[model samples]
Every structure is written in C-alpha cells, then in structure tokens.
Target: MENKTNNYSYLRFAQEGKECIYDLFDAFLKKTIIEDRAIDFSKSMTVGDDGSIEFVTLEKDGAEVAFSELVGGDPSYKSVFELYLRRKACKAKDQLTARLALACAHLHWLWSLGMDCKTSCGMYGEAISVEEHWMDSLEDYNRESGLWHVNLSEAGVKQDLTLVFAIFHRFVTWPTRPQFKSVNQVKTALVEFVFKSKKNSGAPVRNGLLHLCDPDKYINWYSFESKTMFVTFHSEYLRGYKVSDYSELLAQDSLYYTRKYPKGMKLDPYQANRTEEKICYIFDRMEDNMPA
Candidate 1:
C-alpha cells in the first residue's frame, strides 16, 4: 500500500517541494536535527541582517555541536545546505539568496504528482498571483482555453500509495495561521473583504501586484463602497509587512474592531490571517486526464 523505497525518496521530495534549501533543511529540522529520535530543536539562532537566521548551536543531552558541522553529516541534505552557505558567503543579492532558492526549487514536488503548477515572477512586493490578472492577459493567438502553453504534461496516473503525500501548502496551510477552520472561510474573507474593495467590482489591473496602500492615504482608492478592510491585510493582497507599518495601520483604525460576544454569537469563530507561504505539496493523484 505504500512505497517507502530509497529511504522515502519520493515522499520527502513531495513534502518539502524544493521551495529552497531552507525548506529542505526544514524537513530535517523537523526530523533529524530537531526530531525526537535523535536531534532535538533546542537550538539557538544568531540573527543576521534583514532578519535572517543562522543556526548557531544545537544542544542535546548536555552535548553541544556546531550547527553547521551537524548538518554536514547528511549527504542528501548536506549538498544543498552547502550551496546556501556559499551563497550567503559570497553576498550575491545576499538578502534574496533565500528567496531565490525558494523560487528556483519552485514546485517540483507538486509537478511530480501530476499537477499543472503555475508560477509567475515579479518584483519583491508584487502579488505572486491574482486569478483576475492571469486570465485578462491571454493573447488572441491561443486556441483551446486560451492558455499559452502546456508545462506539466507527461500523462497522469491514478496511483495512490500510503507513503506518498502532496499538497497546495500555501493556499491550504495559510488559512491555519489566520485561524480559519477551512479554506472556504479564507475564500469568503477574501471575497467579502478584499475582492469587493475600492470598486466592489473585480476590476482587472495589469501588473495587479498588491503594493501595500495605506487606507488613510488611499482611502478613496482602497475603500469599498460599504465595506472596510477590517483585517490586517488590505483588500486582495496578503502580506507580512514591517512592524512599524502594521502597528501604525492598526492604530489608525476605527476599521478593526473587537466584540465581546458570547462563544456562539460570533461568525463561526473563524479568524483570518496570512503568513509567508514557502511550500506547496501535492499529496495525491487520482485522475488520468492530467500529466505530471
């Protein structure tokens, strides 16, 4: 029922999604180094410029090992880990080294399970995606659904195995931090709060990258006719911005409110928030129409 071959080669790749070297390290961080069987995560981090974290030391059973040396022991993870260190060592767009590695890894794990993984590259603060923007940019030359190309098509298989796991981690996992009970709730919050903002109509703006706009400064441009952006994020864009900025926005608000209603009086007790989405995994493949 499960393919636990090659020390779970396929499953590990699917779990981490090659988002970056950090993600790969993260998997082991959850498993080897920090996982209870051998490594415990009672480690210290030394922060570098721009909030970057460097693993300093790991303590276990009163034994301390240099973090870098501990990582070098694993051949599978060690290779890429070395590369990440080299990138940091050279200072090449050094701040974005992590981001680019995450991007380059892309969604290979998702692709492995036979899904058309769509990705778009843009500036740092840009919206990585907006379905509205993607659809509007179709050119006339295309036929059949007006899609430009077929990227992940090798034919799909209806193979289900126990150890194999996959997911759309960001879209699915993000709602968790925001406290939404389900993905649908996240969708509802987006539709009610963001999609209808500033025009209440889904007006398509090319380069619709969600640059953060202060509600007070851009009220005329950001405000929906009747609804206010009550949540931390502005209308459609999800972001984790600077503390000073977030703090300022919250203080200026008659927008965000707190209600002391009894437990069941609330709107399903579903809260919403967003965090930086680093990985997306595809846990299953059950159809033959698509390709991997």
Candidate 2:
C-alpha cells in the first residue's frame, strides 16, 4: 500500500510537469504563427467573410467549458477569462467578449485612419497586456493572490488602457469579487483605484472603455457632442434605453462554444474608416435638412 501510494504521487507529479511543458510549447507555437503571418504594413488589412476584423488567432483544438462551470461562474472572473480566451482562441460569445471584439475592431480601424491621436492611443490601450508578454501574465495569474499582489510588477499607465489592464488583472487574480455587480460598477471602481485624479480621465477614452466592456449598456461615441447629436437627432432610439451598469444583462448573452464556432471576438483594421464614412453621410444629410 505504501509503495502504491508513492507510485500514484509520482505519476501525478509527472503529469503536471508534462502539462507545464505542453503549455510552454503551445506558447512558442502561437508566437511563431503570429510572426509568420505578420501584417505587411505596405498592404491594407482586409475583413474576413464572417464580418469580423482580421486578427491573428491560434488555430488549435478549441476547448469548451460550460458557462455555469466557467471560472466557477463568477461573473467578474468569467469576463476576464472570456476576453483572454476570445483573443487567444478567437472565441467570443458573451456580451462582454463580443463588445471587446467590436471595440478592438473599431479602435483598430481608427488606428488605420489616423483619425486623430486618440485613435492610436485607444488601439494600443486595447492591445497591451500587464506583463512582459500576455502569455506571461496568464501563466503568472495565481488565484491565491489578491489584486494588490497580482503580477503587475511591470504595469504602467497605458493611456486609457491603464484602466482596462487594471480591470483584467483585478478580475483574474483577485480571490473574491468586489460587492459591485455591473460592468460599469467594476469600471468605476477600477478608475478610482487606478487613476490618481479625475484630470487623468478623458471622457471619450474612459467612456469608450466602458462601451468595450458592455456595448448594449454603453455607447462608444468618441465625443460628448456625438452622443448629444445621437440623442437629439435620434431620441426615439434611446427613449426606453436605460443603461444599467450591472451584470444582470450578461445572463441574456448568447453563449455557446464549439470547435467550429469558438468565442466570437474579432479585431479588424479598416472598419473605422467605413464607419466614419457612414457617419459623414448622416451628417451631410442632417446639415442639409435640420436647422443649426
């Protein structure tokens, strides 16, 4: 019996070590794939047939976890992992993941347009990770450690992205969720904790971050004037639209993961220019018809 117990322990150790090795190899392959398919700056980025912005994704055996069993079904934890996996595996089905993909796609598009400095800032904000490398952060995440002690020793102010990174780190490493229940609540709390003063907060940048977290509940208009225009010219669209800053809506999100259709996140580069053209068309018509 003693010898059998020793053998079992040895086997378990060996298996864990083997898994660690596999994870390292997987990371190497993913990096190689991304490098091999590096976007040629001389050529324009294109959209995929699925209507998502073309971004690199690891084409590996997709893994599925029931929504109920995901990160123990903790809404906050689930959201962080969802974004991470969606980016890593191109899987995004839930509201948060979907919005993240959309926001990143739009931000990337804006980057391509050189619309303004904010476009470039927002793009880097979404792309950055908290560690020397993103996979390092994933590997360093220890649930036993709390937010203050997570693997953010290398963290920096990534413009508005500082808030996004802080949120991701908090959700993934924090042992427990804060009392907040909504995505904005999480954002607001993180903003207070991460930014030293309100002066550092830019409305479009911060609000855009909020929209990325929950598109149904928040709009990603780049300016307050744009939001006002949408409200003034399209009041009926927002008549009953009470933006709730909570996670209750996450329950209604369409979520299913399979090998064929993993999470549904996308990041495209040219989408911003197209969206801008449509907005300009609307403005042109409004200018001709509406009183200033």
Candidate 3:
C-alpha cells in the first residue's frame, strides 16, 4: 500500500508539475520588464529535427556564453527567479524539488526574455569518446547448479536525471517566439515526458549522478568505488572546457560526496549531488560579478 501511495503521489506530482511550470512561465511573462538592449537572443537558435534545443553561445563584450548562462545571468528575471526558488526550497527543506523547480524557473526566464529562443525534440550531437568496459567473458554456472546466469547491464536506460533536468530547463525557459510552442503546451509536455521517462525506467530506482554522452548514452562514473568516470561533454565554442570538466571537479572534492551510497554501490539518487548545486552556484556567482 505504501508503494501504491508513492506511485500515486508521483503521478499526481507529474500532472500538477505541468501546471506548476505553466503558472511559473505565465507569471514570469507578466512580471518581467524587457530591457531595451536585450539581444534577441533567440535569433539563429534552432530546436533541431530532434527534440533537443541547439544551444549556441553568443558573444557579448568579447566573451562567449551559451544561451543557458546568458538567460541565467540576466539580472532582471533569471537571477531573481533563481534566488526565490533557492530560498523557497531551503525554507521547505526540499532541495531536490527546489532544484527541479529552479530548473523550470530558468526555462520560464528564458522564454520571457525573447521569442527568438526556441527548443527542439531530439539530440544535439554525438558525445566525446572514452574507454568503456565491456563484458568480455561471462561464467556459465547453470550447468553446475551452483549459481544463476549473468547478463550485461541493459543499454538505453538513462541513469542520469541531470541531462533530462537540464534539457527540460532549457525547454521551459525558451523565449516566447513565433516558432515556439505555447507555454502551456511546453510545460505539459515537460511534465509528461519526465513522468514517461521515469515510468519507462521500470522502477523508481535512483542511480548516482549521470551525465549524457547524448540522450541515449549516459555515463555514471562518480561512485564511492569507482570514484570517477571520465567523460567528454559537447560544447559549441570551447573545445577544452566541456561538461565533463565540471564532473571531474566534483569527483575530486570529498565534500561533494552524498554519503548516501552503501560501502560498495554508487550514491543514491535521492541524495543531493553537489554538481547540480555547483552549476546553480556558478550561475549565481556570475550574476553577482556582473556590474550593477
């Protein structure tokens, strides 16, 4: 019965989650004051043939920054929304939910910023290559009647929620424009997609911090046992500093470990990973450094 209740709660959460996201977007649109100098940041952006948004960085004052950071760095909408969500989540003692909420807020903030911003429905591109372990051999013990059979871990299971979260964040925050979907539709789709992704994963199992090579291939390298997973993240502008750079930093810092994993297994998903928090913190810091 407890399991049933949790299932139902999540179902309801998904449904209402869409509404919550839509409401936030609506509020942002109504409340934000557009800056005259605000670049039509949505220009040149495409949602792609697939569902993924093609994020490209723009040059401002000789610095290149992605749309995510640009919208996030905006003083008027993005910063305020992030600050509010941080406080609200802290007050409720639900940081995970809070982070999710902030991600949604970021989407709304982006959407409100301009119409040129758009979203797509598929993957951006390929992932950086790395050495991956393959099961070269498997012992057959069924004939001996001493042990059961073994199987390679299933492929296509998305263990990382961060990429999903980040993608949804970008979708929701997409600026209102001629090509974009209605805010309500975007919100509903995000909630529905998240629920579907979770449901398809078979069970409510949480894997440790997951980063995507693409939406289909995810790498889970941060573990108490493995301690680190080497990966290369795609960047439009910079070749050296990729998403994996951030992951490497988190792995080195003992303070970032969740301490929720057993002695052997990876950390629990429910426990807060510092990587996501660090991303948000960096955004906040950037906002602070910008001239007022």
Clashes of each: 9, 6, 20
Best of the two (2, 3) by lDDT: 2
After superposition, the stretches of candidate 2 with alpha carbons farther than 4 Å from their true spots are 1-158, 177-203, 224-292
The residue-by-residue lDDT of candidate 1 on 1-292, one tens digit each, is 1111112223322222222222222332233223212222223323334333333333445875332332223334433433543342422254344332322222222122122233221121132221112212222211122111223243221111100111111122233335545323433343323222232222211001010111111111111211122222232232332333465444534332222225553322111111111110111111222476
Candidate-wise lDDT, in order? 0.24, 0.31, 0.28
**lDDT of candidate 2 over 66-110, digit per residue (tens):** 211212334575346434534444334565554344334322332
Instruction: Report the lDDT of model 1 for residue 133.
Output: 28
lDDT of 3 by residue, 1-292 (tens): 0001111122211222122222222333222212111222233323323322222233456864233432333335534443543442322235433333433433333322211122211111001111111101112111111011112153221223233333333443546523324433333333323333323232111221121111112122223222221111211222233354666545534422233335454333322233343333343445556898
Report the Cα lDDT for candidate 2. Answer: 0.31
**In candidate 2, residue 86 scores what lDDT?**
40
Is candidate 2 or 3 superior in TM-score? 2
> Model 1 misses residue 100 by how many Å?
8.6
lDDT of 2 at 270: 17
Candidate 1, which ten residues in sequence have the lowest lDDT sum? 206-215
TM-score of 2: 0.25
At residue 252, candidate 2 shows an lDDT of 23
Instruction: Flag regions of model 1 displaced more than 4 Å.
Output: 1-92, 96-178, 196-292
The per-prediction CA RMSD against the true structure, in angstroms, equals: 21.0, 22.1, 22.6
